[model samples]
Target: MEFLWTSFEIVGTIAFAISGALVGVSRRMDIFGMLVLALATAIGGGIVRDILVGHFPPNSLQTGFYVLLTLAVTIAVFMVYRSKQDHHMSTRWVRRIYLTADTIGLASFTVTGTSVGVYAYPQYPIFCMILGILTAVGGGMIRDVLAQRVPSVLREEVYALPAIIGSAVYYVFGYDGAWLYASYGSFITVFLIRTAAIRYEWSLPRVY
Candidate 1:
Protein backbone atom coordinates (compact mmCIF):
# COMPACT_ATOMS: atom_id res chain seq x y z
CA MET A 1 0.00 0.00 0.00
CA GLU A 2 2.76 2.44 0.82
CA PHE A 3 4.60 1.62 -2.38
CA LEU A 4 1.53 2.08 -4.49
CA TRP A 5 0.66 5.33 -2.78
CA THR A 6 4.15 6.75 -3.22
CA SER A 7 4.27 5.66 -6.85
CA PHE A 8 1.02 7.44 -7.62
CA GLU A 9 2.20 10.58 -5.89
CA ILE A 10 5.44 10.65 -7.87
CA VAL A 11 3.68 10.05 -11.16
CA GLY A 12 1.08 12.68 -10.42
CA THR A 13 3.72 15.16 -9.37
CA ILE A 14 5.73 14.70 -12.53
CA ALA A 15 2.68 14.94 -14.75
CA PHE A 16 1.36 18.05 -13.06
CA ALA A 17 4.78 19.65 -13.17
CA ILE A 18 4.93 19.10 -16.90
CA SER A 19 1.49 20.57 -17.40
CA GLY A 20 2.34 23.58 -15.26
CA ALA A 21 5.62 24.18 -17.04
CA LEU A 22 3.80 24.12 -20.32
CA VAL A 23 1.39 26.70 -19.01
CA GLY A 24 4.26 28.90 -17.96
CA VAL A 25 5.78 28.58 -21.39
CA SER A 26 2.48 29.55 -22.95
CA ARG A 27 2.33 32.61 -20.73
CA ARG A 28 5.89 33.50 -21.73
CA MET A 29 7.07 33.39 -18.15
CA ASP A 30 10.71 33.42 -17.12
CA ILE A 31 12.50 30.38 -15.73
CA PHE A 32 11.79 31.38 -12.12
CA GLY A 33 8.15 31.91 -12.90
CA MET A 34 8.01 28.57 -14.67
CA LEU A 35 9.51 26.84 -11.66
CA VAL A 36 7.03 28.50 -9.35
CA LEU A 37 4.11 27.46 -11.49
CA ALA A 38 5.42 23.93 -11.83
CA LEU A 39 5.84 23.50 -8.11
CA ALA A 40 2.44 24.96 -7.37
CA THR A 41 0.66 22.68 -9.80
CA ALA A 42 2.66 19.66 -8.72
CA ILE A 43 1.98 19.90 -4.99
CA GLY A 44 -0.83 22.36 -4.45
CA GLY A 45 -3.48 19.66 -4.34
CA GLY A 46 -1.47 17.44 -2.03
CA ILE A 47 -0.97 20.34 0.34
CA VAL A 48 -4.68 20.94 0.40
CA ARG A 49 -5.35 17.25 0.96
CA ASP A 50 -2.92 17.13 3.85
CA ILE A 51 -4.58 20.10 5.46
CA LEU A 52 -7.99 18.48 5.18
CA VAL A 53 -6.63 15.27 6.71
CA GLY A 54 -5.12 17.31 9.55
CA HIS A 55 -1.62 16.50 8.51
CA PHE A 56 -0.06 19.73 9.76
CA PRO A 57 2.49 21.65 7.71
CA PRO A 58 1.72 19.30 4.76
CA ASN A 59 3.98 16.52 3.50
CA SER A 60 5.31 18.56 0.59
CA LEU A 61 6.44 21.30 2.93
CA GLN A 62 8.03 18.86 5.36
CA THR A 63 10.07 17.05 2.72
CA GLY A 64 12.14 18.54 -0.09
CA PHE A 65 11.86 15.47 -2.33
CA TYR A 66 8.70 16.50 -4.16
CA VAL A 67 9.91 20.06 -4.57
CA LEU A 68 13.21 18.86 -5.97
CA LEU A 69 11.47 16.53 -8.36
CA THR A 70 9.20 19.31 -9.54
CA LEU A 71 12.18 21.60 -10.01
CA ALA A 72 13.92 19.03 -12.16
CA VAL A 73 10.82 18.59 -14.26
CA THR A 74 10.37 22.33 -14.64
CA ILE A 75 13.96 22.81 -15.75
CA ALA A 76 13.65 20.07 -18.35
CA VAL A 77 10.43 21.52 -19.66
CA PHE A 78 11.98 24.95 -19.80
CA MET A 79 14.95 23.74 -21.85
CA VAL A 80 12.82 21.82 -24.31
CA TYR A 81 10.18 24.51 -24.70
CA ARG A 82 12.83 27.15 -24.98
CA SER A 83 14.44 25.30 -27.83
CA LYS A 84 11.10 24.89 -29.53
CA GLN A 85 10.05 28.43 -28.85
CA ASP A 86 12.56 29.78 -31.35
CA HIS A 87 10.84 27.75 -34.00
CA HIS A 88 7.17 28.12 -34.59
CA MET A 89 5.48 25.42 -32.52
CA SER A 90 2.49 23.68 -33.91
CA THR A 91 -0.56 24.68 -31.92
CA ARG A 92 -2.08 21.25 -32.29
CA TRP A 93 0.99 19.51 -30.90
CA VAL A 94 1.21 21.90 -27.95
CA ARG A 95 -2.43 21.33 -27.15
CA ARG A 96 -1.97 17.59 -27.35
CA ILE A 97 0.98 17.64 -24.99
CA TYR A 98 -0.83 19.81 -22.46
CA LEU A 99 -3.96 17.70 -22.57
CA THR A 100 -2.06 14.43 -22.21
CA ALA A 101 -0.01 15.63 -19.25
CA ASP A 102 -3.00 17.24 -17.54
CA THR A 103 -5.16 14.14 -18.02
CA ILE A 104 -2.44 11.91 -16.58
CA GLY A 105 -1.97 14.20 -13.58
CA LEU A 106 -5.69 14.30 -13.00
CA ALA A 107 -5.94 10.50 -13.00
CA SER A 108 -2.88 9.87 -10.85
CA PHE A 109 -3.91 12.43 -8.26
CA THR A 110 -7.45 11.10 -8.20
CA VAL A 111 -6.20 7.68 -7.19
CA THR A 112 -3.74 8.97 -4.61
CA GLY A 113 -6.17 11.44 -3.09
CA THR A 114 -9.02 8.94 -2.98
CA SER A 115 -6.78 6.36 -1.36
CA VAL A 116 -5.69 8.86 1.28
CA GLY A 117 -9.30 9.70 2.07
CA VAL A 118 -10.29 6.04 2.32
CA TYR A 119 -7.40 5.27 4.61
CA ALA A 120 -7.94 8.32 6.75
CA TYR A 121 -11.71 8.28 7.10
CA PRO A 122 -13.17 5.03 5.89
CA GLN A 123 -16.48 5.65 7.58
CA TYR A 124 -17.23 8.80 5.60
CA PRO A 125 -17.48 7.88 1.93
CA ILE A 126 -18.70 11.27 0.78
CA PHE A 127 -15.78 13.01 2.42
CA CYS A 128 -13.47 10.62 0.65
CA MET A 129 -15.07 11.42 -2.67
CA ILE A 130 -14.88 15.14 -2.11
CA LEU A 131 -11.23 14.94 -1.17
CA GLY A 132 -10.54 12.90 -4.26
CA ILE A 133 -12.21 15.43 -6.49
CA LEU A 134 -10.55 18.40 -4.83
CA THR A 135 -7.15 16.80 -4.84
CA ALA A 136 -7.44 16.07 -8.52
CA VAL A 137 -8.54 19.55 -9.61
CA GLY A 138 -7.08 21.85 -7.01
CA GLY A 139 -3.67 22.14 -8.61
CA GLY A 140 -5.06 22.82 -12.03
CA MET A 141 -7.26 25.50 -10.54
CA ILE A 142 -4.24 27.16 -9.00
CA ARG A 143 -2.30 26.89 -12.24
CA ASP A 144 -5.09 28.48 -14.26
CA VAL A 145 -5.61 31.27 -11.80
CA LEU A 146 -1.93 32.12 -11.85
CA ALA A 147 -2.06 32.13 -15.62
CA GLN A 148 -5.00 34.51 -15.48
CA ARG A 149 -7.36 32.08 -17.15
CA VAL A 150 -10.56 30.39 -16.14
CA PRO A 151 -10.02 27.08 -14.45
CA SER A 152 -10.68 24.00 -16.52
CA VAL A 153 -13.09 22.59 -13.95
CA LEU A 154 -15.21 25.70 -14.38
CA ARG A 155 -15.01 25.40 -18.14
CA GLU A 156 -17.65 23.57 -20.14
CA GLU A 157 -15.43 20.56 -20.62
CA VAL A 158 -15.92 17.30 -18.75
CA TYR A 159 -12.98 17.76 -16.43
CA ALA A 160 -14.12 17.18 -12.85
CA LEU A 161 -16.64 14.53 -13.85
CA PRO A 162 -13.93 11.98 -14.48
CA ALA A 163 -12.40 12.67 -11.07
CA ILE A 164 -15.82 12.40 -9.47
CA ILE A 165 -16.50 9.09 -11.13
CA GLY A 166 -13.03 7.78 -10.38
CA SER A 167 -13.40 8.69 -6.71
CA ALA A 168 -16.77 6.95 -6.59
CA VAL A 169 -15.28 3.85 -8.19
CA TYR A 170 -12.47 3.74 -5.64
CA TYR A 171 -14.82 4.34 -2.74
CA VAL A 172 -16.93 1.42 -3.86
CA PHE A 173 -14.03 -0.99 -4.44
CA GLY A 174 -11.37 0.27 -2.04
CA TYR A 175 -12.72 -1.61 0.98
CA ASP A 176 -11.31 -4.76 2.51
CA GLY A 177 -7.97 -5.83 1.01
CA ALA A 178 -8.71 -4.55 -2.48
CA TRP A 179 -6.82 -1.29 -2.16
CA LEU A 180 -4.24 -1.98 -4.87
CA TYR A 181 -6.87 -3.06 -7.31
CA ALA A 182 -9.01 -0.09 -6.42
CA SER A 183 -6.15 2.32 -6.99
CA TYR A 184 -5.32 0.97 -10.43
CA GLY A 185 -8.99 0.78 -11.33
CA SER A 186 -9.60 4.35 -10.26
CA PHE A 187 -6.53 5.67 -12.10
CA ILE A 188 -7.40 3.85 -15.30
CA THR A 189 -11.03 4.92 -15.16
CA VAL A 190 -10.12 8.56 -14.66
CA PHE A 191 -7.50 8.50 -17.40
CA LEU A 192 -9.76 6.84 -19.94
CA ILE A 193 -12.73 9.05 -19.18
CA ARG A 194 -10.75 12.26 -19.44
CA THR A 195 -8.99 11.06 -22.58
CA ALA A 196 -12.30 10.18 -24.20
CA ALA A 197 -13.80 13.47 -23.16
CA ILE A 198 -10.91 15.28 -24.84
CA ARG A 199 -11.08 13.14 -27.95
CA TYR A 200 -14.83 13.54 -28.26
CA GLU A 201 -14.86 17.13 -27.05
CA TRP A 202 -17.32 16.24 -24.35
CA SER A 203 -18.78 19.18 -22.47
CA LEU A 204 -21.60 19.98 -20.14
CA PRO A 205 -24.55 22.06 -21.26
CA ARG A 206 -23.80 25.74 -21.54
CA VAL A 207 -26.17 28.41 -20.27
CA TYR A 208 -25.14 30.95 -22.90
Candidate 2:
Protein backbone atom coordinates (compact mmCIF):
# COMPACT_ATOMS: atom_id res chain seq x y z
CA MET A 1 0.00 0.00 0.00
CA GLU A 2 2.79 2.38 0.91
CA PHE A 3 4.55 1.60 -2.32
CA LEU A 4 1.38 2.20 -4.28
CA TRP A 5 0.83 5.54 -2.63
CA THR A 6 4.39 6.63 -3.34
CA SER A 7 4.08 5.59 -6.95
CA PHE A 8 0.90 7.62 -7.43
CA GLU A 9 2.47 10.64 -5.78
CA ILE A 10 5.33 10.71 -8.28
CA VAL A 11 3.09 10.00 -11.23
CA GLY A 12 0.61 12.63 -10.11
CA THR A 13 3.41 15.14 -9.75
CA ILE A 14 4.63 14.52 -13.27
CA ALA A 15 1.19 14.54 -14.82
CA PHE A 16 0.20 17.75 -13.08
CA ALA A 17 3.41 19.43 -14.14
CA ILE A 18 2.89 18.47 -17.73
CA SER A 19 -0.71 19.63 -17.73
CA GLY A 20 0.13 22.98 -16.17
CA ALA A 21 3.02 23.53 -18.53
CA LEU A 22 0.75 22.78 -21.45
CA VAL A 23 -1.61 25.51 -20.29
CA GLY A 24 1.27 27.95 -19.92
CA VAL A 25 2.57 27.18 -23.36
CA SER A 26 -0.86 27.78 -24.85
CA ARG A 27 -1.08 31.12 -23.04
CA ARG A 28 2.28 32.16 -24.49
CA MET A 29 3.84 32.56 -21.08
CA ASP A 30 7.55 33.11 -20.74
CA ILE A 31 9.83 30.49 -19.25
CA PHE A 32 9.59 31.87 -15.71
CA GLY A 33 5.81 32.13 -15.82
CA MET A 34 5.48 28.63 -17.19
CA LEU A 35 7.72 27.23 -14.47
CA VAL A 36 5.73 28.98 -11.80
CA LEU A 37 2.45 27.62 -13.08
CA ALA A 38 3.90 24.13 -13.46
CA LEU A 39 5.24 24.15 -9.92
CA ALA A 40 1.97 25.36 -8.47
CA THR A 41 -0.13 22.88 -10.40
CA ALA A 42 2.23 20.05 -9.51
CA ILE A 43 2.33 20.51 -5.73
CA GLY A 44 0.01 23.30 -4.59
CA GLY A 45 -2.69 20.91 -3.48
CA GLY A 46 -0.29 18.74 -1.51
CA ILE A 47 1.07 21.82 0.22
CA VAL A 48 -2.40 23.03 1.06
CA ARG A 49 -3.36 19.61 2.43
CA ASP A 50 -0.23 19.40 4.54
CA ILE A 51 -0.84 22.80 6.07
CA LEU A 52 -4.48 22.05 6.72
CA VAL A 53 -3.45 18.88 8.52
CA GLY A 54 -0.97 20.89 10.61
CA HIS A 55 2.09 19.48 8.94
CA PHE A 56 4.63 22.27 9.30
CA PRO A 57 6.34 23.62 6.23
CA PRO A 58 4.71 20.82 4.20
CA ASN A 59 6.62 17.75 3.09
CA SER A 60 6.59 18.94 -0.53
CA LEU A 61 8.62 22.03 0.29
CA GLN A 62 11.13 19.95 2.17
CA THR A 63 12.12 18.10 -0.97
CA GLY A 64 13.74 19.36 -4.14
CA PHE A 65 12.69 16.36 -6.22
CA TYR A 66 9.24 17.72 -7.11
CA VAL A 67 10.62 21.17 -7.86
CA LEU A 68 13.28 19.74 -10.07
CA LEU A 69 10.77 17.52 -11.78
CA THR A 70 8.43 20.41 -12.53
CA LEU A 71 11.28 22.55 -13.82
CA ALA A 72 12.43 19.83 -16.18
CA VAL A 73 8.95 19.25 -17.54
CA THR A 74 8.23 22.95 -18.05
CA ILE A 75 11.47 23.47 -19.96
CA ALA A 76 10.84 20.43 -22.10
CA VAL A 77 7.34 21.59 -22.95
CA PHE A 78 8.59 25.06 -23.78
CA MET A 79 11.15 23.66 -26.13
CA VAL A 80 8.83 21.25 -27.89
CA TYR A 81 5.90 23.64 -28.11
CA ARG A 82 7.97 26.46 -29.49
CA SER A 83 9.74 24.21 -31.98
CA LYS A 84 6.50 22.65 -33.26
CA GLN A 85 4.52 25.86 -33.65
CA ASP A 86 6.37 26.54 -36.91
CA HIS A 87 4.86 23.31 -38.26
CA HIS A 88 1.37 24.58 -37.32
CA MET A 89 0.85 22.10 -34.52
CA SER A 90 -2.77 22.36 -33.56
CA THR A 91 -3.94 23.46 -30.12
CA ARG A 92 -6.53 20.71 -30.45
CA TRP A 93 -3.86 18.08 -29.98
CA VAL A 94 -2.47 19.99 -27.04
CA ARG A 95 -5.90 20.20 -25.48
CA ARG A 96 -6.41 16.48 -25.92
CA ILE A 97 -3.08 15.65 -24.34
CA TYR A 98 -3.63 18.07 -21.46
CA LEU A 99 -7.07 16.67 -20.73
CA THR A 100 -5.77 13.12 -20.62
CA ALA A 101 -2.80 13.98 -18.42
CA ASP A 102 -4.77 16.27 -16.11
CA THR A 103 -7.45 13.66 -15.58
CA ILE A 104 -4.85 11.16 -14.45
CA GLY A 105 -3.35 13.65 -12.05
CA LEU A 106 -6.73 14.53 -10.61
CA ALA A 107 -7.64 10.94 -9.88
CA SER A 108 -4.25 9.88 -8.57
CA PHE A 109 -3.87 12.84 -6.26
CA THR A 110 -7.38 12.50 -4.92
CA VAL A 111 -6.92 8.85 -4.02
CA THR A 112 -3.52 9.40 -2.46
CA GLY A 113 -4.75 12.34 -0.44
CA THR A 114 -7.79 10.41 0.70
CA SER A 115 -5.57 7.57 1.82
CA VAL A 116 -3.37 9.93 3.77
CA GLY A 117 -6.38 11.66 5.28
CA VAL A 118 -7.86 8.31 6.33
CA TYR A 119 -4.66 7.44 8.11
CA ALA A 120 -4.46 10.88 9.68
CA TYR A 121 -8.04 11.11 10.80
CA PRO A 122 -9.38 7.63 11.11
CA GLN A 123 -12.46 8.65 13.00
CA TYR A 124 -13.42 11.51 10.66
CA PRO A 125 -14.34 10.00 7.36
CA ILE A 126 -15.94 13.21 6.09
CA PHE A 127 -12.77 15.13 6.73
CA CYS A 128 -10.84 12.51 4.85
CA MET A 129 -13.10 12.90 1.82
CA ILE A 130 -12.91 16.65 1.90
CA LEU A 131 -9.14 16.57 1.99
CA GLY A 132 -9.16 14.17 -0.88
CA ILE A 133 -11.29 16.41 -3.07
CA LEU A 134 -9.24 19.44 -2.20
CA THR A 135 -6.03 17.63 -2.96
CA ALA A 136 -7.39 16.73 -6.36
CA VAL A 137 -8.67 20.08 -7.58
CA GLY A 138 -7.11 22.71 -5.39
CA GLY A 139 -4.05 23.12 -7.55
CA GLY A 140 -6.10 23.59 -10.66
CA MET A 141 -8.10 26.26 -8.90
CA ILE A 142 -4.93 28.01 -7.92
CA ARG A 143 -3.56 27.72 -11.42
CA ASP A 144 -6.64 29.29 -12.96
CA VAL A 145 -6.66 32.09 -10.42
CA LEU A 146 -3.05 32.92 -11.18
CA ALA A 147 -3.84 32.98 -14.86
CA GLN A 148 -6.81 35.34 -14.32
CA ARG A 149 -9.41 32.81 -15.32
CA VAL A 150 -12.42 31.40 -13.54
CA PRO A 151 -11.50 28.21 -11.79
CA SER A 152 -12.85 25.16 -13.58
CA VAL A 153 -14.26 23.77 -10.34
CA LEU A 154 -16.63 26.71 -10.14
CA ARG A 155 -17.95 26.38 -13.69
CA GLU A 156 -17.24 22.90 -14.99
CA GLU A 157 -20.17 20.73 -14.05
CA VAL A 158 -18.41 17.48 -13.42
CA TYR A 159 -14.94 18.72 -12.65
CA ALA A 160 -14.71 18.78 -8.87
CA LEU A 161 -17.67 16.45 -8.57
CA PRO A 162 -15.67 13.54 -9.86
CA ALA A 163 -13.05 14.04 -7.20
CA ILE A 164 -15.75 14.37 -4.57
CA ILE A 165 -17.31 11.13 -5.69
CA GLY A 166 -13.91 9.45 -5.89
CA SER A 167 -13.13 10.53 -2.35
CA ALA A 168 -16.43 9.18 -1.11
CA VAL A 169 -15.70 5.88 -2.78
CA TYR A 170 -12.28 5.84 -1.18
CA TYR A 171 -13.80 6.48 2.23
CA VAL A 172 -16.38 3.73 1.92
CA PHE A 173 -13.94 1.10 0.70
CA GLY A 174 -11.30 2.02 3.23
CA TYR A 175 -13.85 2.05 6.04
CA ASP A 176 -15.22 -1.35 5.07
CA GLY A 177 -11.93 -2.97 4.14
CA ALA A 178 -13.62 -4.08 0.95
CA TRP A 179 -10.44 -4.30 -1.08
CA LEU A 180 -6.69 -3.95 -0.75
CA TYR A 181 -6.60 -1.70 -3.79
CA ALA A 182 -9.40 0.68 -2.93
CA SER A 183 -7.31 3.64 -3.96
CA TYR A 184 -6.93 2.34 -7.46
CA GLY A 185 -10.66 1.74 -7.67
CA SER A 186 -11.36 5.31 -6.65
CA PHE A 187 -8.82 6.54 -9.18
CA ILE A 188 -10.52 4.63 -11.99
CA THR A 189 -13.90 6.07 -11.06
CA VAL A 190 -12.65 9.64 -11.16
CA PHE A 191 -10.75 9.14 -14.38
CA LEU A 192 -13.72 7.60 -16.15
CA ILE A 193 -16.09 10.35 -15.09
CA ARG A 194 -13.69 13.10 -16.14
CA THR A 195 -13.20 11.43 -19.50
CA ALA A 196 -16.93 11.26 -19.96
CA ALA A 197 -17.32 14.92 -19.05
CA ILE A 198 -14.80 15.84 -21.71
CA ARG A 199 -16.25 13.51 -24.34
CA TYR A 200 -19.90 14.36 -23.77
CA GLU A 201 -19.46 17.97 -22.77
CA TRP A 202 -21.38 17.38 -19.56
CA SER A 203 -22.36 20.55 -17.79
CA LEU A 204 -24.47 21.71 -14.91
CA PRO A 205 -27.70 23.51 -15.66
CA ARG A 206 -27.12 27.22 -15.89
CA VAL A 207 -28.91 29.56 -13.54
CA TYR A 208 -30.91 32.31 -15.25
TM-score per candidate: 0.96, 0.94
lDDT of 2 by residue, 82-166 (tens): 7774535486788888999899999988987888888889799889998999899988888889988788788677898899899
Query: For each candidate, C-alpha RMSD in Å?
Result: 1.3, 1.5
Clash tally, candidates in order: 0, 0
The TM-score of candidate 1 is 0.96
TM-score of 2: 0.94
Q: What C-alpha lDDT do the candidate models reach, one value each?
A: 0.90, 0.86
Give candidate 1 misplaced runs (Cα > 4 Å).
none
| lDDT, residue 178, candidate 2 | 49
Error of 2 at 133 (Å): 0.6
Q: List the pairs of residues colliding in candidate 1.
A: none
Which candidate's lDDT is highest? 1
